[model samples]
Target: MKINKNIAISDSGFVFNPVNGESFSVNPIGAEIIDMMKTEKSYEEIHKTLISKYNADEATIEKDYFDFVGLLKQHNLIDNNEEA
Candidate 1:
């Protein structure tokens, strides 16, 4: 999935949707995922990178990644037309 171009994300994990005027805060890991998504990283690449950089296993990372993406989707933070 791709982050919507209009969404504003802060380095401190603050996310703002200008369209809806909705703001949210995420953890460090969630910030990293948002950064990677903004860079157009694929899910598999994100999963691999997280595994190599952190102590988490592949399965855990994969599950968390998808769950995060799902939340983004539910909140309309992602661009459904774009491939992530």
Candidate 2:
């Protein structure tokens, strides 16, 4: 999925959505996920990268990833026109 073009993110995990004037702070993993998404990384690529970098199992990662993406969708952080 792609982040909204108007959203701004920082290396320190701070995210700002200019469209809504909303800001958020994410955990390190979440930051990494957002960074990867900004690059238009596919789910498989993200899954493999997370699997190699983290100790979590595939099922756990899968669940968390989807949950996070859902949250992003709910918050309108992802571009609606983009395919996940």
RMSD of each: 1.5, 1.2
Displacement of the residue 27 alpha carbon in candidate 2, Å: 0.5
lDDT of 1 by residue, 1-84 (tens): 679878888999999999999999999999999998889888879888899999988888888888888889889898766554
What lDDT score is found at residue 7 in candidate 1?
Answer: 84
Which model scores highest in TM-score? 2
lDDT of 2 by residue, 1-84 (tens): 788877788989999999999999999999999989888789999999999999999999999999999889889999767666
Superposition error at 73 for model 2 (Å): 0.4
TM per prediction: 0.90, 0.92
